[model samples]
Target: MGKIVFKRLVEVQILHDYFLTMGDGISFFQRNKKEKEELLTQRINRGLYSAGSIFKISPITANKLRDNKILFAETSSGFILGVEVDEVIEAGELRFKPVHDISKKLDLSFSLTTKLPFFKSFTNLELEKSLPSINYFTNKKATLLNENTVPAYTSMPLTKTAPAHQAGETYEMGTILDFGGTIREANQRTDGNDPAHWEDIDDRRFVTRADKVLLPHNFKIKFKDYQLVTQLEVSLEDTGNNKIKKIVKNSAEPFKDISLNFSKIDENDKDSPNIPSGIYYLNLKINGATEIVYSILLDNDLYDYQNFGVVELGFEEVNSPYSLLDTQGFLKTKIEAGGQKVSHPIFEIRLKNRRSYWRYKKNTDFTPSEIAATSNHLEVAASNILVAKKPKALTETLLPFKNGTNLLLPTPKVAGIRVENEKIYSDIHINQSNGLLKI
Candidate 1:
């Protein structure tokens, strides 16, 4: 397979005053010219060295350098000679003037091989002197010799500890890669990698599971009713530090139920408390005598009691002396009050096989509105016959029933009527006065 190559070409201008030679190396002027030439040469060499050093220490550059796939070159443009021309009128006579001079600027070009086509441009040679000096080899011996430091290898075999890279795995930017002593960062993420899809985080400054953090939680403890325990005491102690975060104590009259509540408190506002997620011990005392302890985990928000009341309904067949009735059913309903009282309750009965026979005229024997009209009649009949009363006080008005009890609902008067006919003609009409029908 062919190898990928990257090239960086840089060209900079150097002013004549910086590297011009005055005379040969013989007289005082000659010595000054030689010194100036030496200084200029040193500056140019340093600039080239700085540029190469910056790229050499790069992770990709170092890897390529190890494989002997890198190159560096520098070139200078030869002296450029040119002439300037101008039109002049000297002594009322038009004349053409020409002046010859050498350019006062020197062009220097530098080229370096890189693993990636990423480079910075320098407008002039002075800018190169401003580049910061970075010593990749920080060791005393390595710095003195102007050489890169190499790690000492051991005879022991190296073990592969890192897991193999899996497909679709993503890593976040600024992820550090430690190559024994040298460290580099994966700063670019132009590929299919995104920090949002990263699974694991090595930084402790970020929170991973926000829901697991401790927040304000409501708790309530109620003593059984009609018991000797009229007082209750509750306290929550942090298991890690044995610190008492919250405490509550309450008392009630004799034979009365006692309830104690505890929660995280914030003095400034009642929003949330600054609690840490951990295990806590909940201590409870009944009548300031009986003590009980329980362990609870407070990693998530919790509520002690149900918010909505529950209603349960049960149905059972009952014996009926009326032979015309197919079956008699009784409804047994129970309502359990929760944190709040329920003033109104709604009960719905659904027929699984109910179809739009009245609107669609599925039954040709019956009129289109027969089912709809009969439903209204049955509802009125049921309201008139069905009466709710307390089982103990049979004559009393309907009241809230907290416990399960049987309800007596009499059959409606319209239940025995046959709403559908066998084969009734559409034009048939009945004479109300004589009770005779014409078909």
Candidate 2:
């Protein structure tokens, strides 16, 4: 029925150990990371913990005394009854100075001399028990009071699709007449209707027009149908890692809303090649009701096999098999270390030349020897890559090769020969007679 005036009072309590706590002693205090530890504890202990005492006194009756630090006192009796002292300045105001001073004309008590600490270093020191409580008499009945200052509240409608507020924007609420059993407008209106009886309710009290009653009073709204979308675009990168990089984008799609769930797959062990490998997967979702799962695979570094072993071959070496063959049918070896005339299989085919020739050579008729050699080469390469067992050498030469295998080579299985393939799904075998690998 009346207006209520609300006054705010902020109390900051100073602890006796505040200065000591700030010194380089406590690990957290020195780090300054937990600076709020003492302050917050003081606030909780003095403010919230003493809410009943604070509400019953102070600005509610008397204001808090401001000094180097906050000081709480009782003003309900009108005079500032110093209950807690933070410094000598605060104690001086409460008449806690010595009575035997030169200016002894003022009224002072012996309690003040005994209660006040020696002047110099000071802190939040309580004197309630050391000093006697003084009763300061005052007239509370003389202060003017307004009975019409009662508390009133207005509902705050939740905003829907509203833009952020800008400077100078008007904040107004349309008037409402009886509907939700509550008066709608906030402040009193100026239009004169009831001269003697003025209700704290706004002048725009009743709905002025019939159309105004039908208009939606609340503007806030909630979405009815919502959805979410998440996608990961994967592309190949020509890097040493030879990995498929994925770009993830999540959205509610048309609605522009999305939710995400992140979890670590502790039990998921990935050993096979196909399934992507990662320690954790990010599960994306849309609104709590509708979900979109987006799996985030951890990234890793991988070395390319092609770049390796290239440096071992000299700079004069060609990059591909075709280039190597173009330079020389095969790498020329010393026939007899300073003698170039003799013959003893004086050259070896480079791996690059072999791969290039195999990649570009026209599909030709595969003789039985060529097929066998191709199979042997593929088996050996696979074994090297997967660390599997080497294939058995099945060499059958038409020439009178001693022991049925190549006489020059001691073992049918080329023990020293190292083979590797870079092409996708490549299978090659060596043919003894043809002396070449067939794919």
Candidate 3:
């Protein structure tokens, strides 16, 4: 009886002609439930046709832990997914494991994530809201459970330190390091170098007093394909007001570990740029491939009067000679809360299949090639990003409020960024009272 009703529904609005058909004898369907709306995009129902080309995409704001089944289909413009999270489970500690075969490819973060049985995990949050205060551990001790309230802990002034490994040592060749210090250590983790397995390296975050000094020192960084000296430049500066000014430093480091001794530009050297001490920005220019990568550390704090910046690096692809990701290209920004503070900052942008996008931007090597971003202000063009395997359609937005606000309506909230597929729909809009929407 249920199957009869579903077949009737499929018959209600069937298309007369075929547009896309898979290898098997599956058919495509369409309806004029409002012809214009039908022309925009079609939703794939589970039982309407062969599930071969059937794609499913959940609404943008769906909680990933819901155990939603996200299967995708390929399209010329991009991929299409029909999402259904009807079988939701209780949200627990976030956990994900990278797909092994995908990792072996020249893809890093682009590696596919599978539902692995790890004990813990967390997602980057938009700046307006606090991340779920999970016990985040580094090379140190940790708390037993998740904290509901963000305890206000005072922070000590930050110090920039780089530790070099013994000479003649080589790592598995992963994310590049700026100081040539601690780059290999992150993937190696606290257990020390483990050629047995790999771990995701959390971006280093530091809180500092504006007047803190970053004394100069010598360090070594390993670059792939060529000697340490090919196409590398280091710029340290301030990026608080949404612009970049060279934080004038004098670096004459040219050899292997690229010594970085930054000193104030002298008056006699008026040509040198000047940098005031408040928040420091670290920028690195390097060639990026699947293997050769680097890391830039910045402040991941949410408190006011906090000084921070992120490490931004750019690299050229060895195969195509095209740039892959932005050098600090994707915006990781923060805004002041409405006279209130939160626990920690969430990453403003989320890129799905980030590595996959690089894999197929030029060729059709992969299927279901898509990239997803939940950001407040994202400009792919400025970053030279122009494509997403398919055109994205907004399903629904997930938003969080501040200062005990309960309502989730557009009237009171700011919609800072709206992007889909490869087109920019809405520009970033914000108010001092209400910063970019923490979506």
How much RMSD separates candidate 3 from the native structure? Answer: 25.7
For candidate 1, what is the lDDT? 0.25
Best by TM-score: 3
Residues 102-164 of candidate 3: C-alpha lDDT, one tens digit per residue: 111121111011121210111111112111111111111111221122341222111122233
Ranking by lDDT: 1, 3, 2
- The candidate maximizing lDDT is 1
Write the candidate numbers in order of decreasing TM-score: 3, 1, 2
**TM-score against truth, every candidate:** 0.19, 0.12, 0.20
Candidate 2: where is the Cα deviation over 4 Å? 1-248, 251-361, 379-439
Per-residue alpha-carbon lDDT of candidate 1 for residues 1-439, written as tens digits (9 for 90 to 100): 6433222211211222212222221211122324533654664565521323222211222332233322323233111111223334444433322222211121111112222121111100111111111111100111011112123111110111112222332222323222233332223221233333222312111101111112224433333333455555666777664656545445456534332233444434677675554456666665666555554444332211111101111111122211101131111111223323211111111001100111111212333243233342222212212111211111112222122233212211111111122110111122233211111
By the TM-score metric, which is better: model 1 or model 3? Answer: 3
- How close to the true structure is residue 294 of candidate 2, measured as C-alpha lDDT? 19
Q: What's the true lDDT of residue 154 in model 3? A: 23
Poorest 10 consecutive residues by lDDT, candidate 3: 4-13
lDDT of 2 by residue, 17-39 (tens): 22223222231112221353454
Give candidate 1's TM-score: 0.19
